[model samples]
Target: MLFSLVKKDLLLAKKYLMFMTIFSFVSPLLIASRSSFSDTGFVSLLITVLLTEYILYISISSLEDKSKGAALLCTTPYKRNGVIKAKYLLILIIFMCCFILYTILTYLGISPNIQQMSITKIGTIMLVLSIFFGILIPVQVKFGYEKTKYIGFIIVFLTPFVLPNLIKWYTSSNLSINFTISLSQNIYGWIPFVLSLIIGYISMQVSIRIYSKKDL
Candidate 1:
């Protein structure tokens, strides 16, 4: 039942998925051209942008039918929790597609060097994305689609501008300057990543709970 709901949703969203695929393939080339073939920042920025776009697009697409009352997925035999799980499943699949595309581009020399990749950086990126998605999904479920879209847009636009400066301020004033990254070759790199994952998981659970109780 859950699978059926997911399939229906995906069928409706196929056009967007196709767009994402084409974008993923072209992203590396675009980044390379923009950066004058500078590998690191361009690839990182491209990956970040691609992931953000896909996450938002999928979230919006998934809720479209529900918002319009054109379909009855929310009223199916599947538990609301199962419906949510299906979303995560679809998201993971889409995310994997992006990862694979990026990997191929890296290998083909259109992207950055794979060997220079920092697990910490990747983990941080995933954590940020998880938090963004986690916050947005439940809000969409509770408040309906249009309001959530505005809220999501505001957060996405503001966060990149806000976070770095906030971080710099905090670090500069702190005496210890203690910050951690996950997956550093040294023993401590995993701390921030693990912590972020935990937070992301908790945020997801909260979103699920909110969604489960909503009148949709």
Candidate 2:
């Protein structure tokens, strides 16, 4: 049943999925072209992975909200919990798809740097995704995607401006300096990787609670 719901969403968002695929293929070249930095490979990989997930997830949520499909889904055997579970499952699937595409691009030599994606990079990417989905899913479940998307836009626009300051603050602070240093070690990837999965699980629970109580 959960798989069916995932399949339904995928089918409904096929056009957006196609767009995501195209973006995944072209983003590396575009990002590499725009940046002369040595870390352009990492930058390209990060953007490609993050944006692909963003496009698919946002499109699915928007499609559901715009069509008033959530209310209808709740009326079916799927119900609210199933609907919420399907969303999380869909996100997991999307992440895997992105990783596979990344691997293929690397193998095909289309990616900027074949060796750029490592376990540490994967862990960092997953951590970022966990935080994003953790906040985004519950908020969207409560308010619907149409309303939450503006906030999404604001964050996307402000992140570059805010991130450097935040990093500087963190580096200057002694409180989390050790933790930050530890994360920089490649061997610690498993720690954040585990934490990412936990965050994703908790996020799903929160979204389920929000959607369950939602009037829609």
TM-score of each: 0.71, 0.83
Q: Which ten residues in a row have the lowest lDDT in candidate 1?
A: 34-43
lDDT of 2 by residue, 1-216 (tens): 999999998998888777788778777777667654455555666666766777777777788877889888877877788888888888778878877776777778865454346677687778887898789889888877878997766765455445445645655685553445534555676776888899999999988887777887
Query: What are the root-mean-square deviations of the candidates from the true structure over C-alphas?
Result: 4.8, 3.8
Which residue segments of model 1 deviate by more than 4 Å?
Answer: 1-5, 35-71, 111-116, 154-189
Q: Ten residues in a row with the worst lDDT in model 2?
A: 175-184
- The residue pairs that clash in candidate 2, if any, are none
Q: How close to the true structure is residue 48 of candidate 2, measured as C-alpha lDDT? A: 69
lDDT of 1 by residue, 1-216 (tens): 667766866776765767767777675456445442223443444354545465545455546645653235566566667767666556545555666676676677754433234566555555566666666666666776766666666665665445445555655687565456554475564654686668656766776797777765
